[model samples]
Target: MFRTEISMLAACALAGAAHGQNLADLSLDQLSRIEVTSVGKRLQRVADVAGSVYVITADDIRRCGATTLPEVLRLAPNLQVARVDGAQYAISARTGTDLLANKMLVLVDGRTVYSPLFSGVFWEAIEMPLDDIERIEVLSGSGGTLYGSNAFHGVINIVTRSAGETAGTLVKGAVGTSERFVTLRHGAASDAGAFRVFAKKRDAENTQRASGAPVRDASRHQLAGFRWDGGTPQRQFTGTGEVYHHRTEDVLGERDYHGAYVLGRYIEDAGGRRTQLQAYADRLVRERSRTIRNTVDTLDLELQQQQLPTAGMDLLWGAGWRLYRDDAQPASPAALDLLPRRKYLHLWNAFAQVEMEGAAASRFTLGLKAEHNAYTGLELLPTLRYSWRPSEDSNVWAAASRVVRTPARVDRDVASPPLVPNPSVRAEKADIAELGWRGRFGSGASASLTAFAHRFGQLRSFDLNGATGVFANNYGGWLRGLEGWAEWFPAQNLRLKAGMLLQHPRYDAAAGTSPQPPSVTLGNDARHLFKLGVAWDVRHNVWVDFHVRHVGRRPAPAVPSYLAADARVAWRPAPSVELSAAVRNLGEPRHVEWGAPATASLVPRSLLLQFVWWP
Candidate 1:
């Protein structure tokens, strides 16, 4: 499955350029111009967000030396991304779980991608041309105020660029010692609107040699889409759609999935008032080596309004709903009476946030979200925050929020005798409180830091009997951590970015914890993790980046400690062609994250070479 015959190639002209100024030369004023919608779903500078967040742009993805979505996720300060063999990855932030992972809600274009089967984002199947991403917003801790449900620990928003913004003809392909990747992007504009379509394919042999080694992970994506803009920016309507497919090798067997989706939204602003409506539906098929297969279809809709009903106060509100269904395989007449499956269960939610501006240097925010789920019934999430800015250089803020982890389909099905259901499971709950600081110095540097803790109740896990797929209540646990990050680009060419994180988790009763091995340090969580990277511009058109990272160890999980680093150099040989090469995991064994001791890791040292042509 070679996308291109790979061979050693020198860095393109971008990396060949002579170095005079480094990325560190860029001042604070310059970096503030990058547009971000991660915080409030509105354009604002990165510094405006009240919590610890990171923005990974398309360029950053290329320059960071990564191949898959999991690799890109590693850039987040304390987030852990560990590969389970070739296709599966155990990913989590701050807190780790044994039976079920119910933290971290992941969204693609505002659509929830976590499976109701386990309350975790299947990190796999998030296939899209990396080049199409506008930016990735990583928000840590209790985003339940807006995202609802499993947004217990953190939130990841993967936003794509508009077809209109990417109008052009581009082809990008890559080759590596053990893998190959390629993508094609083309766009056009007409009276109806601007449209762009792209396709990507990747195949890789095992980096490590062994039968059943979890290598040979292969996947492909076919997406054809267009955005039709019908009116002005303030009053506009747009639509887009895509079809995609993905296949991966896993521990049990391979799972192939194919799907299509279409989305449309309309916005209107009149008399200082604004309103919006959006809807989308997607269908996916899951085919496993086993005889049983499943098909899932999801439908989503949203409506929102924002206005200043009274002076000095701003009000924003929105409601959303999602319907999900998984059709089971047809059975013989004898088994027709087995547990029946339903095609739909409505989840309806509404939220409103009010921001009050106070005189002098203070502001206040009050918000709440209410949702009704068939499994866990009604849930209410609330948030309260206050901020004060004494001077242009600094601002301090604090917030308290309540979040819940709604029960998933797995909570009921998979009993020991097979399809029997468990009716006693309940939702996991959490209470979070945090304080943060944002500051900018006249000397041209800025930073953000957040200190937070979470109290959990009714955590779910497999029953001690372990006889059924059913899960039951586990005693409460606690998570506390500190996250801080900063970016300094003194110049356009040279940039320095760094992040640090620390966390500790305490289980109230060590007795009944199922899979945790005896070696785990009591109450000891993952230790300190750190990240540092520097991007330098060398001469004419050459740019080079070096990144180094450290992953600490933790309990029950035999996750080994490791230090790994990656380096990349890119050159623009011509205005239309660029060449690049990168190396990953230079100094460590195959690694993984957020899994029980049984989780496997299948990775070896690897290399990647790619070419980009934009005309």
Candidate 2:
């Protein structure tokens, strides 16, 4: 398998070089100038942000041959991504990875997608057409001051293209050793605006346990969505809706899940001031042969404004409200259950940020947020940041922040035996400090580096109160890490990217108690990680890409260190047709990224062929 992949890569690279015509869409300098809106809730250049961030462009996603959002996220070096099974993944930034990682916040076109029940994203429920994605901005640091609560560790914002940009018909199909999928999209232009509708279906085979026994984790998914873009630049309006269904098999039984959502937004820009309002409603349902069955309905509304309040000063403020009504039922009397079968959860938050320019191209920013939740009445989050531009292509930044991870329904409502709920549970807290630098070396290279230290308190731990095992806050710890990535344009048509991360963490009991596995597990992390990637647009219509990653061993549960590689070759035979072949997990037939080795599911190697057409 390794030899075959290498031969294919060699041939593609030679062919592309012989037929090369133009450089990739954007140059190194142009990439630095790309505007992003997640760092500070306002548009800013990548080189100007005072945080640790990485941007994955549309071209990068296309060349990587990743059919799903989770797969695409692996391209960002700032994140730790693990394939748990055939249809499940564990992803986190600057923290431990888990099946239900709640520290990271995810947004699709500015709409929150995290679940209220677990305070984590259901990756299986997010089934959007990948072809419409414009870009993804990944920030590997706390965003609580502006995003609030669950935005404790990091944030991922997915931006999609407008209807006008996809005004045509598109069809895509892919078949692999273990999976198959098909998608269709159609768009049209109108006097008022443009509109598009799309649908997709996918099926995946089951993964296997260490003993070669099938895990029965196969899955199927179907999704449909529509979007409309209207109005002018100064006063724009947009609306979107989506419906999806997914089914999967587990060791215990089979499960079916479905959901639908609709969202609308209006933005007005007057001179140097901007105002935006958005609203959305969503419903989700789950049915299972075992475990629990549940339904959740959500309503959310938000308003924000940005203005140049004075000379060399900018102001940004926002407010939001969200409500969730959840109903749950257990499959059996002995199964786990949430008390008060029916419950309502409400969240309210308001935030403000001020940025002022100082002497010698320096800038200072202060932000604060006050948030209230059903479990925790009110909490305050604050951040202070400063940046100095020593040159046109270099920036030095530092920041200090205090944030908290509010309790989720699962944290305080479980009413099953062997596990007792604690309604008085307090929020987990963190105090962080960071120093970073970003620089562009001419048009051929660019780089970013950041060092961070986080002090944690009131961490969740399992406590034996008399005879009952109650969830409690009895642990504390500290984490310090260094992360950085660099990009180089070795040639007009060839680009190379490399990144690395190194960290050290320590944990202990609050005082007299001994350290528990649950407390140490809070920072179950890899000591170091490294990644390298190559993208060569050999020709005007041919491309070759390769990615290699190395993860150090993890403690506690003990996940062995491993190195993996992926390669892809694509060619456009005509103006409207393209074909690609890719291989994942090259050389390594199977490996486990999470769970105990004896019970962990193995991720298998796969070879795939894909076709895309625009007619």
Candidate 3:
């Protein structure tokens, strides 16, 4: 059945490619001029951002042939995205490569998505309809002053299209060796407002171990959501809600999880000034191995204002409050347990940023944030940045920032079988400095390079000297790296992008000269990384894209270097229809991207066919 479905989709794509041109065949010149908003919280040309930033547009996402958020994120050069199983992924930026990477902050439409339970994101539990996403903005350096704690290394903001922009019906389906997925959506626009609703379902097969045995990591997921946008010309209102359920089978055992969230926002713009009020609530429940069950509920509120207070200055300020509650229960007495059984957390923060444009094309920015949490008292974060524009096409920028990662539930309250609580754990902090340059050459070529150094204090570690293991902030370290990417459109129809990263990281004991753990599993750092991508408009309506990536060896669990490649061919047969075929992991049958060598499973190659209909 899978083969038959894929064959039909391929046939349709080929037929469409043979036809005439379509709107999807946008010129490379137009794409380079796209605008981005994450750098300074205001819309600006991509080439003008002073930081190491990357933008993944909707067209780019369409050509990548990715089925999940993690797969789509692989396109960003600064991120390390690793596949752990059929439904799990380990992703981070600049530092850390663990199953629960906690250094990077992620937001979807202004809503934070990380779990306070582990101070990390559970990739498998977060899902969205890919077609609804407008763009993904990735900042490869500290953003603590604007995003608060946990934005220690970087931030990823996923922005979705407005309801008015999607006023139609869309249906998408895919079948492949690894998974099957389907989606249905409808949108409508009226004088009063615009609304959209969607439903999606997916099922995936299990991966294999090195011995060619099935790992039983298969999974299934279902998601439904709705979005509404409306209001008068001066006042704008937006509301969104989603519900999801997921089930997975793994080596440890079977797991079931469900979650729901609702978000609302009101924005007003007048005379070069803007104000926004936003609120959201989320609830999640999980059952693992038939032995452990956990539940979490969260409510958040924020108010922000932006204004051009003076001819040469721009000001942005915001305040936010959040409340979180967690409950854990083990089916068996000897199973997993959480201290206090039930816990409540409260967080409050305020932030402000000022940008000044000086004479001779120079700009300076200063930002500060203060946050108070239940575990940690008041913490302050500060950042300073300067940019010099020598010409319209070239820019030089530098920045210094301080960031922190606050303790999580696991750090202060976990009391599972072999682990004990440690209420004394403090927030980990870092001071980072970065210098970068961006330039646009003749024609459609552009490049960016960045060098950064960071000194970390109070890093987290696990101590096993006592009867039960305890988490502590007992290490310090220095990390330095160079990262860059270049893009070129050699021909009118061909485009190429290449990126590389190199780093050196070292750790030492806070007190004595004792040797640190040989297996630094906390933040697995890789020394070298590289990626290359190519997109060619082979014909009027046909497009082909190819991507290759290499990740160097990591310490601790000792993950060896590996190379992977992907290719996709897409065609628009009609103005309202598209079809594509893709192959992932073309270089190898299966390989382990992360985790301990002894128990790691292999991620296998996959062939997929997809179709989209809009009318």
Candidate 4:
């Protein structure tokens, strides 16, 4: 049974790392550190965060039992997840250069999760409850001077915490051999503040090497929220609500979905000057055989005042209004407007950031972003970053930005069959540059390395709409890449992490040159990748972990590259009881990338056994 749940979580992390060091506690690599918030926009520490960041917590998603969310986002190795069927998923970061808007930019607790009707991001309608998340700040490239428009290839901020930091009431369950699960979480606090709720259910039936294609996977998710850091935790007011549903097995059968969203946030900081507010509402519906419905209502309100009447300089501005609707009824009624078409998207953005601390350690950051979109209305995204810490653990940062990618609904309107619509489209822009260097040696662990170059202009592909339909992005392309990462704790119970990525993409000659299977560089890129992980402790209440991933190998439009390994263990024994077991694709070779062909096979090995109870 998956190696007996990874040998009973390695005998409960070596019986709690043999008391790590009596008289108190502090094992697990000395309680670990180096948090993140995807660089710029707050939450630092990753060696002071000068760029290129990464953080995934919640105890690394329960020691990596992964169960979805693209397997905990493929444990970030510069990200590049694929599985295009059965609840679809296709995450990207770094290269293949975000086909017509791949340029990453996602948010869950902060709203904004792709989809303007195909800017894409339906990662199975996001259920995120991976233990009520509390971190996930992956930021590799541009953020348009602080998140403004399709971030241009890097920015993943999925933050969720506060419920008084998981008050109480918890439960967990699991099954293996292809996958099965159960989850629940609850929390509470008094003084009119703090609350939490979570739920999860999943079913599995993997293994279907094709025979008319079938995987029939099942999925379910739920979440609830409430918070009242109540003025003083730097002023606050937060609210959240989420709902999701899933169904798999496509082609004439399974293809169901359900979605719901609600969000409200307000945070204010007086002495340090900081203010913010956000609003959201989303609804989605999809069913088998051509029934699609989408609704979006968002009001992102922002206001910032920092280092205000003092310090160096900093300011943030915002204004948003998005209202989208999609009916898409297609049972063939002369194809009424051929379905899929509803527009009411509006956006207006304002940004400003200036932090200059000249001489000595040097520091300079000037930012600006102005946007107006409703299908290319107005735009001006600008930003520049400069840093030079020279010493104090080293630091060096460089940045340049201007990004945009708007126009979905199949780029204006799609009608299945082949593709359609092109409402005079024009919304594809990229001009990016980034350089990074972050450090923290002295055996404390921390490292970073970044390199980027983007220069795109109006890129989209697919055409010829009548004779049976077809129309999407009549062609355009160009991309580039390079990435690096590191983390180490040398001794003290271990803690290691590593990453690497390199890519190249093209076909800008208007993509003419005839066709045969040309989508230029094919469905985003995945050049070369490498990832490694190790987390020990192996003693005291137990804890054991290991991860290894490698995905590389490509041609014009064919992907096949593999390597996988995962293992986990955890045990608490008392004090509310806790137990864990994990094993995923351990040595289960065969791999492929880019989704949709029933997720392109090769996913075997799976197991999980969990139990939790709280005080």
* Candidate with the greatest lDDT versus the true structure: 2
TM-score of 4: 0.32
Ranking by TM-score: 2, 3, 1, 4
Writing each residue's lDDT as its tens digit, candidate 4 over 53-123 gives: 77675566667768777689878777777664345666777764333335578886667777666666767
Higher-scoring candidate on TM-score, 2 or 3: 2
> Candidate 2 on 42-92: residue-level lDDT in tens?
777788999998988767777787888899999999898888877788788
Greater-lDDT candidate between 2 and 3:
2
TM of each candidate vs. truth: 0.88, 0.95, 0.94, 0.32
Please report how far candidate 3 places residue 501 from its true position, in Å: 1.3
Q: What is the lDDT of residue 82 in candidate 4?
A: 63
lDDT of each: 0.67, 0.83, 0.83, 0.63
lDDT of 1 by residue, 1-615 (tens): 000001111111112121112344335654444445444444445555555567676656767767778788888885756565555666666775322345788877666777766677656666667776656778777778778887887888887665665668879888997678788888876666667777777776643332334444554444455445456656766676778777776444677777788888787878777787888888877666553455778898988777845777878888999888866563332332113554456789998888888877887888899998878789999988777788866778788999998877656654334234667878888898889997776754677788989898876655444543445556577878888877775665667778888887665643655633212311224567888888888855677988888768755555666678888888888877888899877776454443443434446667899888987
Could you tell me how far off, in angstroms, the CA of residue 416 lies in candidate 3 after the best superposition? 2.3
The residue-by-residue lDDT of candidate 3 on 431-527, one tens digit each, is: 9999999888876788889999999998888777545677788778898999999888778778789998888877777684333472443577688
lDDT-superior candidate, 1 or 2:
2
Comparison by TM-score, 1 against 2, better one: 2
RMSD values for the candidates in order, in angstroms, are 6.5, 5.9, 5.7, 23.1
lDDT of 4 at 286: 65
In candidate 1, what residue range of length 10 has the lowest lDDT sum?
1-10
- Best to worst by lDDT, what's the order? 2, 3, 1, 4
